[model samples]
Target: MTDGTTQPKPPRPPRRKRVVLADSRAPVTVLRTVLELEEQTSWAEEVVRGFIRTQFWTAVKLALLVIGTLGALPLVFFLAPGLSGVTVVGVPLPWILLGIVPFPLLFGLAYWYNVLAERHERDFVDMVEK
Candidate 1:
């Protein structure tokens, strides 16, 4: 009466350290791996500080560019009043510059910021992962 089919083996216990809950019948859960920063890890701290400095400088540069451009509009208009009178298909140059031009310029700046931030993050990740 032996058909020769072998039975499956039982599951093995987990290898990692696990903490069982206070409940009488609760299952054991594996501990999550956490980053230890309190120890003497000056290299990691330096890398983080450098990354933050790079980000801070990047933001300051972009802000100066945007603010400088917008701030110069009044000076340009003041210096060259004729520019405000110029029209393109019945719309004044000032209207075009102030209303229509900024959207694309802002979007371009935002795109550049996203690219730069991603690059910074990628470099940071590579340094840490290595």
Candidate 2:
């Protein structure tokens, strides 16, 4: 057995590598699944309709609240004409309420609505996922 040629060695296989991600536990979305749901069930449509209704009612309610609060101010001034002449720090009360106060109040309402709408969307997503 000494003088002959040797057999060739087998080739080595490639090494497997692991991948790291920034967020491992995030929920995954599939377009195919969503499309299937849309085509196959009314549930998605109902959920969207419900979401729209919730948003619409929320907007309506906030609108009414703003209108009522600001509208009543004018009515109060008209009913009590002496109030218009009253001043605080040399600024008319009506001007303070109508001009200065409303901007902040409206901004607050808009912020609240944004938060509410986001919460609604989150809830809808949760429901859909379930």
Candidate 3:
């Protein structure tokens, strides 16, 4: 118990050597569907055509909705001539309705379109992957 000498430590185990099975410089093969898509095969073109059609219809619907909402404003003002006299914070009711209101409405519609578009793309990708 009174010895001043310290005991030597045990040897550690050897480290594992990394073994690579594949050559890093070799060209990797792409998936069949991915290759088809890139090469624009008939099947791939059809799938892409369907996606474009869906997007076109979506844009058309949104455009119609915007047209309907904005288009109705002028008709409403014309029908109710008394509305022209109305004002909010020194700005005419028509001015606020036409200028301020459309921004938020358009923004909301854009957000909706973006969500639907992303969903459609996601679905398309899933279908392709399968």
Candidate 4:
């Protein structure tokens, strides 16, 4: 026995609106705003890049400062006079290497390096900005 069934109808066609392409000749107002935003973004990016360079140079200088300090240790002791009890226990003042002098010297050097590094970068960026 065969059963006869009615077939379902097809879906309706889709509706569409007219398409528009971007016009090359934009209005003066829109173009002006775009230019303003672009300038703002350019300035911001320049600031960010300048900051990056400054920070990098600072790191490099700091590393060099540290290395220089460490390297000078031997020279400092070598140049010190033989023990004369000017320091306690007959230990020469120069013997006070890591315990005293080097620490402060390293710190001072670090501060100096950082300041100079920051200044140089600031000047460069300022120049570019102008």
Candidate 5:
């Protein structure tokens, strides 16, 4: 069966690599081919490195978000009282403002936000990477 387009198909035969000597008459063509292959390899390596950089930035952004969340936890509590009635290191529940609750709270919020932020960043990175 043939489609609307009329085109002649070429026949395929041998599928093997023939070793060419250095002093072959078509040696120049072989050298050109080698250079083209090298260029393609270099381009591929650059693309790989670009992808790596994108991943690296994604990690750094996540780390900063985690640190910021942990650091700001105290501020969140300070701005709004009646959140927790637990004393933390010589400080009143949250009114004294002496210390920012325990590390667990900070760590928890940081941990949670870090994960959330990473998911968001990853979504964005995925959209851009492609």
Candidate 6:
């Protein structure tokens, strides 16, 4: 079992160095517009006020439309009294107009308002982010 010649060990592979992608000590800067908004500067305040004014005017217009349309129904019925007695599927015309019509009208108005409000908000955000 004893061998006179001794065998040498295989050579080892070379080690590789690690590489760094980013430096943590680098300086970071904030945008001027963002800083102004956060600090409530005069410029930022004016911009925000303008956005609110636009939204307020939009709401007022929608409110007027709703009021005018619904308010005119009663006046129309009063002017043409014969129309009030008319029936649809045995239900009074006035009842159907007053009860059923307003729901769809209001729903449509609400959806329109939502779309307008979201558009305004999106515009505001884009302005601010820029």
- Using all chains and alpha carbons, the TM-scores for the candidates as numbered come to 0.68, 0.70, 0.72, 0.42, 0.33, 0.75
Model 4 / residue 56 / CA error / Å: 1.8
Better of 1 and 2 by lDDT: 2
How accurate locally, in lDDT, is each candidate?
Answer: 0.79, 0.83, 0.90, 0.68, 0.61, 0.89
lDDT of 6 by residue, 19-58 (tens): 8644444323326676788899999899999999999999
Q: For this target, which candidate reaches the highest lDDT against the unseen true structure?
A: 3
Clashing pairs in 1: none
Better of 1 and 4 by lDDT: 1
Off by over 4 Å in 1: 1-40
| Model 4 regions more than 4 Å off | 1-43, 72-89, 117-129
Among the numbered candidates, top TM-score falls to 6
- lDDT-better candidate, 1 vs 5: 1
Question: lDDT (0-100) at residue 116 of candidate 4?
Answer: 81
Q: What C-alpha lDDT, on a 0 to 100 scale, does residue 107 get in candidate 6?
A: 97
Among residues 3 or more apart in sequence or in different chains, the pairs in candidate 5 whose N, CA or C atoms overlap within 3 Å are: none
Residues 3-116, model 4: lDDT tens digits: 797778998889888785534576665555455445867655666677778778778878887778777766756675453235756666656765677778878877887788
How many steric clashes between backbone atoms does each model show?
0, 0, 0, 0, 0, 0
Candidate 1 per-residue lDDT, tens place, 11-116, comes to 8987898786444443332111013223426755776789999999999999999999988997999999989899999999999999999899999999999999
CA lDDT, candidate 5, residue 16: 94
lDDT comparing candidate 5 with the true structure: 0.61
Higher-ranked by lDDT: 2 or 3:
3
Give the clash count for model 5: 0
How much does each candidate deviate from the true structure in C-alpha RMSD?
12.1, 13.2, 9.4, 14.1, 15.6, 13.1
Q: What global local distance difference test value does model 1 have?
A: 0.79
Model 4, residue 59: distance off in Å is 2.7
Q: What is the lDDT of residue 74 in candidate 2?
A: 92
